[model samples]
Target: MRRSPWATLTVLALAQFIVVLDVTIVNVALPRIQTDLDFTADGLQWVISAYTLVFGGFLLLGGRAADLLGSRRVFLTGLALFGVTLLVAGLAGTPGALIAARAVQGLGGALMSPAALSILTVTFAHGRQRNIAMGVWGGLAGLGGTLGVVAGGLLVDSLSWRWVFFVNVPVVVALIAATPLIIRAVARRSGHGFDLLGSVLSTAGLLALVYGVVRAEPVGWGSAEVVGCLAAGVVLLAAFVAVEARSAAPLVPLRLFRSRALSSSSGALALNGASFLAMFFLTAIYLQQVRGASALRTGMEILPMGAAAILVAVVTPPLVHRFGTRTVQLCGAALSALSLLLLAGTGADSGYASHLLPGLILFGAGVIAVGVPAQIAAVVDVEHHEAGAASGVVTAFYQVGGALGLALATTLSVSRSHAALADGMAQQQALVEGFHRGLLVAAAFAVVNVVVTLASPRIAPSAEQIAEAAATA
Candidate 1:
């Protein structure tokens, strides 16, 4: 890189942090947004769901375009789009305008994220530098969630909730302008013809799938809209797989799945994502509603989890070097399950220190253990041309997993809460009962991860062994 490689990484890392931050930031500001826009309780969720649906749906397409069209160009375009819509969202006076803006923001995120990851992967050679980059990338993802909650609470309390939307402008503008100066551009390679049909099927299919999952909580799975969406999603996705298998220049190269490293990493990421989201959703509710903590205080309590994840992220490269990717991933899964089981013990009267903190720390460390190495495994074998698409697949699994996990947890928790209420438990106590059940389900997912990690063969070679083999070969 003509510019310092670290400079390129810093800019890309900042951009990604902003992207992930938006995912959770608006949550703290939801009440303010609802009141300001006069949004019905039923309609308010669309603000968040719209972003996730579009972001998850089009990610693969975005990643493919980055590889074929040009990662630098795609990254800049997406960043610009996100910045523009962010301003529009901040200025929006009506519910429709804000919701529409949020959807567009998701599009920008879809376009930007994989391109950024692809760029990062190529910027540093695949070794210690690459591992460091992955650690930063993964760590930023963890930090972003905590920052979102804390920053959102501060911004909303000190200023208007609109600041949550407005805050992206400076960071994005800087990245966009710095792109040419700091980031080296990669030469474009010849690609197979664009698979338009596959693209449409994949994008539409994912959108429908995520939309269905998102709606399941509010409307129930039996609702016509939900059932129709879920069925159509399944069919369209099946069609997408078929198209990819046949297409010469498929958006997602089916052959990539031939790499156990990439495929298994993707699966593990999905499970980790499920556990992560379930923990976030359940714990937040437990703090705010059951424990009567303020939004800022809850954010404060969650800060340690982020801190722990970051700490693990820093040490993970060495751990992988000594232990290998499979071992790190397996141990992480085990830790995550243990953490969830700890959390499952939470009661209506439980204190954060006595109960939540131990679980949160373990969960955070476990996520880093799971996420950083899985990320390394995902793209370790990738050629430059496939980096973007591979990144997209990993990202897609995470988004889908999070949506599915959250839906499952919410359904289980709500049902349990209802049962408790019917059995004459107080509202608060009933809510706690439901939360406990939901947590156990979350714990179960982590345990399942343990089984899968144990059963699945090692996806990638040990770090030093791969380096040595590459040298000899």
Candidate 2:
């Protein structure tokens, strides 16, 4: 029986939104969580780091499982685990319990997010239909980050902090009920069993790498712990590559990288993700430290950016249909760099409407234009079975890149602030100076992406090529 494509899209997109939302939803609630749970300043970061590290680590395994075991099965399993952890975190009696639950939640996100995206590829045939679906999906991916900030502020302010975790219950219940009707089951598999060695190497390598990048902010880049983890991660990732080359059912097929365009697309997505994350971090700081706003106010102030992203996201798919992915991508990157430049010009005295709003809107549109198109190009040439793996890789870039970018930006901000303070600048003045420094670096990243996109061969993959890839998969 054929299911309604739009309905499937809604389910998949909503599932992903909630998963991504969790990434930042707990951020604003941390103060309250700390008060209730006796969390110290140093230990509190674990709330965020635990989830992201595990999430980055397990994404490949989860995506491959969706393909081998079946999307429906993997999706439901992840949903169940996520729901269970949500409840555990909500009802936890101690800081340790909640942190542990959050870690599990990250693993749950790793399992569900890629499987949900994979379902979209098979549900909507490639071309206009898939492009539109991806537009919405990619838009939500962009929106979720901003939405998480706003949603966290709203929930934490109006209700108890526990509500942040508890809010997922009804949504999870509804998704589980709708799963059988909306999701198509994959055919029974006859193949080599799961690649245990590949999964371990990939997961461990990513875990170590993300951890090192994250730790770099507080520990500094040269710390022994950071260096050891990064070195270990490099070695493990290298081993994973060698293992994937030999395995029959590799977690990440090496052939996927055979296309230079696809590989470039992934790298571009990482750069885009890095810029977007760092931009938001700096803006949030501007609102809070410079403007003297509360968490709720900061969230409200950021709302305009998310709205702009949604508007552009809706229109970008059709634009891509008419204009092509490369054109859209290049234009988006150029605009993003401009937006960062505008942001960099601001200071403690800049007004919201005059100085900030224009750039915020530009950034909103810029992220959608670059992100949606880059995602489309990445999977446009892949087969259905490979869709899950491809989705996993794409999302991993977004996750890992965002973490690394935030760490880099945070480090820059701290160093710049210290330098300014040493020169006898006021604390708030020094903070804004740091924000400028970070935004400038982020803009540089956007410029580099534009350069890379221009330098790459124009793929302009046609409808027939897409059809052939789908049929072969």
Candidate 3:
């Protein structure tokens, strides 16, 4: 008997959820890991950055592989590699060993993510089924981020920081076992050579850029090391563009940017990521540092945002249907910006219910609103055969944007806090001032998202219309 499409979707979603959950699960455990491993203040960040840099850098290549090779094979291989790397990371005793393992885990994630999405794209026929599948995919992606915080808090408080990585082992095992039964085998494309040159240039370029930005707080941006890294990154990225323009088989087809919807949606995703990442980082610190909450309490305080986001995600489809994707996206962006502004005003003495709850709820709702519509618009106009590539590009931008935002926020917050400390302010007051600055920056990014979303073309296909079109096609 064949597996139902819904079953296939569920399996794919679970795989993706596991991959995304790792992104935030490690945040709550960072302090614990630092104490255990004796990591330097700057060294601690590498734990997260190592994973993101490798994941973002190799995503395009991974997507292309799924298209040229078989998605199922790549998916299984990725899962196996990810599981192994996670095991190594969990068992790591030294900071160097953990960072290396994290980099390997990221490489595995880069492979798995695109392959999983490609499977979903091919498994579900376009129309109502595809829409529903995408909605579930987006929701799970959002929920994964939330779960990371809560799960990390629980594991870090009870067991050990290593449990965060150890947890992925069982999930990967289950997915690998079930994948063959759920996913249909597809023919591989022949005569599609991998764009080795383009991949090298792009990956190296992105890694260099991220490394430079992340190092700027410890090594001043004006320092020779920082400047050299930034310059090398720019030059390599420029070479990558030149290589792509001339290559017969490019890793990322430069022409895809010609699509107005894809371009707009990608831009919106970047801005959304920038704001959302900053919001999460600053709020986590604010809850812990300024309010003097424990890791568990801080995680619990942010639970409302996660719950609100899930609820809003459930209702987004109908809202999009009624008012159109553009309207909802713009509204969501506006709300997010407002929430950021509210957070920007929060002082050291501010109460969670009076100052934080309203902003968090508004931000959560806005994030879900922007997330669903932006994703819908991204693939709406993409070619069916290139769905994997398209999805990979979106995912890469999302991760890259997040990394950049966090790096910037970290630098800004630290600088502000140091300056306030120099001025004889209390530690809590200095931290709150730094958080306010960070939230203000997040608000500015949210405003940018609103403008970009408004520039996007309308997406208002009814469920019946979509189903009819899919059936006819």
TM-score of each: 0.85, 0.83, 0.89
Candidate 3 residue runs with Cα over 4 Å from true position: 1-10, 39-43, 125-139, 180-184, 382-388, 458-473
Q: Which segments of model 1 are wrong by more than 4 Å?
A: 1-7, 30-49, 91-99, 118-142, 180-186, 213-225, 380-388, 418-425, 464-473
Q: How far does residue 10 in candidate 2 sit from its true spot (Å)?
A: 4.9
lDDT per residue (tens digit) for residues 1-473 in model 3: 77788888888888889887988787767767877899864456567767876787788777778878898898888889999999999999999999999988988998898788778878878767786787688668778978888898888788998999999799899888898988887667676688878867877887787778767767788989889999999999999999989888887788888888788878888788778877886787677657777667777778788888989877876777788779999999999999999989988778889989999989999987887777666666777665445656776777767666666666677777778999999888888888887788888889989889878999885755333322211
Q: What is the C-alpha lDDT of each candidate?
A: 0.78, 0.77, 0.80
**Model 1, range 194-227, lDDT digits (tens) per residue?**
6778767866786676667656656777999999
lDDT of 2 by residue, 1-473 (tens): 88898999888888888887776677656667877899743355467656765676678878777877888889999998998999999999898999899889888888887677668778888677886787677567667766887887788778887888899788998999999998878653457767779767876787677667656656778999999999999999899999999998776778987766667777788888778877876676567657777667777777888888878876876677677778988999999999999999998888888988899989889987887667767777666556545656766776666656665665677678778989999999998898898899889889988987786546465554433332222
Error of 3 at 260 (Å): 2.5
Give the winner by TM-score: 1 or 3: 3
Q: Between which residue pairs do clashes occur in model 2?
A: none
In terms of lDDT, model 1 sits at 0.78
Give RMSD to native, each candidate.
4.0, 3.9, 3.2
- lDDT for 411 in candidate 3 is 66
Candidates ranked by TM-score: 3, 1, 2
